[model samples]
Every structure is written in C-alpha cells, then in structure tokens.
Target: MGTIEYTGNHHAFRDKLRRYLDEAVAPHGEAWEQAGIVPLSAWKEMGEKGYLCTWVPQAYGGRGLDFLYSVIIMEEMAHIGESGFMVSLHSDVVVPYLFTYGSEEIRNQFLPGCVSGDIVAAVAMTEPDAGSDLASMVSTFREEEDCFVLEGSKTFISNGINCGVVIVAARDSLEEEPYNAISLFVVEAGTPGFEKGGKLQKMGLRSQDTAELFFNNCRIPKANLLGQRGSGFIMLMEKLQQERLVCAVSALAGAETLVEQTTKKARECIYGSGMPLIKAQEVRFALVEMTAHLKMARAFVNDLVNQHAAGANVVVETSMAKFLTTDFLNDFSRRSMDLLGEAALDDDDVFAKALRDGRVMPIFAGTNEIMKEIAARFMGL
Candidate 1:
C-alpha cells in the first residue's frame, strides 16, 4: 500500500462547530443563564443560520444534513460548556415527533418555525409522581366533539419557560390502560387555561429553565392531536432510543471536556508546585486508568452513532453507553475534584462547577439503574 491514511470528518465538523460556538453560543451563555432561558431571538438566529435543526428536510427549511452534523453540534456545545441549554434535545429529541407523527397541517403549521427557531418546542411527559414509569401519570384528556379538554400538570419540563409550543402527553380515560390510553397534543403558549408555574431550582444545570405546567381544561382543536389517537406509548418507546443516544453523545462530550480540562489543571499545578500532580504515582495511575476508560467509552458511543446512522437500531448499545459513561463521569468527576483539593470547591473555578454539573449526568435522561435494567434485558436476563 503506497499510502494508508486515517482522515475522518469529525475534525472538520469540530472546526465548523467551533466557529458557531464562539460566534453564537459562548458570548451569550452567561446572559441566558441569568435570564433562566435562552432568548427567542437567539433560537431564530440559529435557525436562520441552518444550525437549529440541521437534519430536518429542506422543504421544512432545514438542510437535511447527516446525523453526524447534529452530533458535532452536540459535541461543540458540550466542549464549550453549555449542556444545560439543551440544543440537542430540542433538535433531536423533541422535533422528531412532529416530523414523524404529525399530520400535514400540523407539520405545515409547526415545522417551518421549528426549523427557524421562531417556535421553541418541548416535550411534556414527566409528571410530579411519574417519571420513568409513565404508567403512573395522572394527567388526563377528555375528548369534546371538535377538540380535547386537557387537564393535567407536568413537572420538570425542560425549556418550560421558553417554549412557545409543547407536545403534551395525557391519559385518554380512567378505564383505559395507562400506556395505551396516552395521547400527545400540541399546546401553544398563552392558552387561556394553560399556565406556567414557578421555576424549580436544581442542584446544577441552573441555566436550563425547568418548570411546572398546569393544564386545566385547556381546550385545543382535534387538529392539534399528534399521530394516531392511541399511539403515544408506541411513539415514545420508538423515540426513546434516539433520546438516549443524544444523552450518550452529550455525556461522552462532557466526559472528554472534563478529562481535558482536568489534565490542564494537573499540568498547571505541576508548573506551580515544581512537580505536576502526575508526579504522584497515585494521580498518575488514576489518569492512566481514566484515560483508558474514557477512550473505550468514546469508541463505543461513536460506534453506536454510526450504527444508528447506518439504519441499525441502537437501543441496547445506547443504553450501555448511557449507563457506563454517565456513571463513570459521575465518579470520575468527583475524583478529579479531589485531586484539585481546595480549588475544586471554589465556585469561581471550572473544576468545581464541572464536579457539580457531572453529578446530574447519572440521574437525568433515565437513571443509570434504568440503563442497567435495559441492558440486562438484552442479555435475556
């Protein structure tokens, strides 16, 4: 072989995304955090630049770019430290429902704006008493000839304050099976009976606005119904793999950033102390082990993304990636904090916030325990 080379597009994608991050995301981050929501103007600007929903079809004002583009977007955002803003969730997790299940009228009404960020979208499924087990959800919707009266409350909704439109899932009736009885509806903001409650403060991800939503007899035309009347459960299950994969990608990106930042911190400490933290055999070995683990985790997630892009379903692999990476990130992040000693506890430092932020990785996007359960099923256990 005259020449054997490895030239991947990830680097080019990263460079393009770096420009977008510096130009669009980085400078405005603190302002968005202070506001507890990203400005609609920012979303519209992203849409205008074809960054909001790159995978959407051109007819809908999207580029119909490859999923790799979306992954690059996710990686760049995480690399620059804005996971809380959740652009991937909006583009990958939430909008797919409209693209896949909505009627032409619904698509015609929403897709263009979603592509342009004129309308911010969120999924309303998690309730106060129900999260992983959606069967226990108490939200109900009653059909009235021309519309449905939605009455329920959703808690812990991402983009709760900023969303101009939300896809809400509610039980059809008391007698129906909770899973099968569920249905999705499009609820616009400022509806008469729909109201947003106070923001729920969290341990981290402070920039992400999470809130409670109250729907009391919120009436919307049957035209707002998404997909078949009884298909919400199936749709949610089908979409969960992509959501889990998005989480997996974000987790890996966050892990990579954490490791890179911590390594720099170690070097800086060495420069100051006359011996780097790596001089300590214990710290040295810890870094070695962490580097190996992270490499394997990233490789696995990359393979899973490829498999998904190639039309293979990645439910099992995505769950494994989510479980392994998030759990590892949680522990590894704390260990890095310990290595940094007093500096780790300082709020002004990135390490302190990384340690705090990484704690939530294992909890959200389905807990690590649930991820393991999903993995166990694949093994016939």
Candidate 2:
C-alpha cells in the first residue's frame, strides 16, 4: 500500500500526458513565462484531454476520477517542467469549493465549463493587507434587495485574468469577527462593478496569470451564496488540509526534480584533477542525506494522501508535511546552486528558474510561519 505505483492504468495516464505535454504544454513554457501569462488555449487543450478537473463527477461532464489522479497530475506537471499554469490550484484548490459548497444550480451551471476548461476558477481571499489572518480582512458585502453588493479588493489571485468564475470570500457585514461574518459567493467574470485589475508581475510563476481584483459595489444574486451564510470561514478551514497537502506535494516534487537534475550535472563535471564533483566524500555524503530525506518525505506524503482518500482528517500532519517539505525545498535549491557553482548564473533557465520558483513555496498557501503556528496549536504547544 505504500508503493507510489505508476503502473497499469496510472502508467498509461502518465505516458499519454507526456505525449500531450511534449506537443502542447512543454513547448509553451518559455513563451508563456516570458509573456507573463499562459494563454487560454493551453488550458483548453488540457481540458479537452480530460486533465483539468479529473475528480469532478461524471454527471457534471467530468471523468469522475479519484484523488490518485490528482497526485499523479501534480507530480507529472513538475516533472514535465511546467509550473506556472497552476492547474492544481484550479482542479484541487479552487474548484472543490464549488463542488462541495456550491448550490445544485450553481454546480450544474459551472462544473461542466470547469471540467472543460472554459471556466477557469480562482479563489479570492487575500487582500492587500490580509493574507494568512483571513479573519482580519476588511472587504465586506451587504444585502442589496435581491442581490449582494460586494465591495473589496483581492490581490495575488492566481488565474485571475483567465478565470471565468471566482469564488470570493467576503464578510457579510462590516464586522471585525470573521467567523460570524465571512461568506463565499460565486462571482462570474464581467459582472457589473467587478473589474479585473492590472496583472502584477512576479519574480517566478510569471505565467500564473495573477492579477488584482476589485469589487466596487459589485452586485450578484443571493443564489450565488455558497453553502450557508456565515460558513465561509468554516469552509476555508475545512479545505486547508487539502490545500496545505497540495503545497507539500508540489514542494516535494520540486525538490525531487532539483536534486535529480543537480546530481546529474555534478556527475558530468570534472575538476582539474578530473574528479567528478560526485566523487568528493562530502558531496557523496550530502547526496546520500538528501536521498534519505526525500525518501522519508515521499513515504510520509503518500501516507497522508492515502489518509485523505480514506476520509481521515490529517490537518496537523499535513501542516507538518507542508512546512517540512517546503522548508527542505528552499534549502535544497540554495545548496544545489552551491554545488553547481557558476552554473547558477543561468537565469531564465530551468536550474535558475527552479531556484527562483522554489523560493515561493514557503510563502504560498499560508506561509511556512503560519503552517508552524497551526502545527503548534495541534501539538498543544
């Protein structure tokens, strides 16, 4: 049961995806990253191949696959050297909110598009000053007869520009208590007063399509409220386990790729004495240590994924996984750069890009600091 098997059906899936990525996804990475956005066509191509929302139910025009498919996609995407598209953020992170909490009508209306990639989804929760402390958000929404007029701004929204729909978290009232006031809504793109702001260029994940979103007296029907009013905080909390798990998964894959790549490069390079870098005793020791760490992380993350599949709550454990894996990723990237020597100057390239991109793992999906805080609480510290 501990085996991370890519055999049989999984093997077929991986092979098919490799062909697709080589044809469509891989070739576009440099152009998309350079342009600061991935085109809609790439996402549409993924959807056509049933790779966008694999877990969605068949009744909603999806393949109704299990979570194993998601794990494969996350790892393979990293393996294929494409990170900025943020497909997991769509299929796993954002769309689940709709699948879990969206009303029947809402699900029927949007799930098909989501599965088909016509409706890219983004979650709008973080604001200019509000990030991890979601309870302290200043954006508020109020009932306006048959509609709710939302007024707020959200930044660092991935897929902001390409999203056809966004699941926005807003306080129902101008109250300081987030628990009692927060609610989620399905706000379609181009809704009146819902304006898409300029894209915010970032150091990495440049093709992420991140943008600032503004809601100025934005009006949406009451039917758009997800689940129950005032349950937004709870909804977000419920999803944190998966979200953090996703971060951990991606971090593990990134670090794996980095170690695998750097080790090969080290083996190929020779000093004046003609000794490959891998020949050094300390270098050998370091590689062995990293191998051990990655092995443990793989086992731990796989166990948690299995737990998640079995419907077991793994909030604290996933938090530990998230921070530990991401923290290791950051350290691994920096040290790999050290081992590679002058090769570190190859910016705008994979090795350099890996370092730049790896820098973000500690910051996203609630920073590593926040991850530790959650773990401490669960630990009774």
Best by lDDT: 2
Q: Report the C-alpha lDDT of model 2 over 40-129, residue by residue, as the tens digit.
A: 988888899999889999999999988888988898888866889899999999999999998899999999999998999999999999
Poorly placed runs, candidate 2 (over 4 Å): 4-7, 174-176
Write down the worst ten-residue block by lDDT for model 1: 1-10
Q: Give the TM-score of candidate 2.
A: 0.97
Please give the lDDT score at residue 108 for candidate 2. 99
C-alpha TM-scores of all predictions: 0.94, 0.97
lDDT of 2 at 71: 88
lDDT of each: 0.82, 0.89
lDDT, candidate 1, equals: 0.82
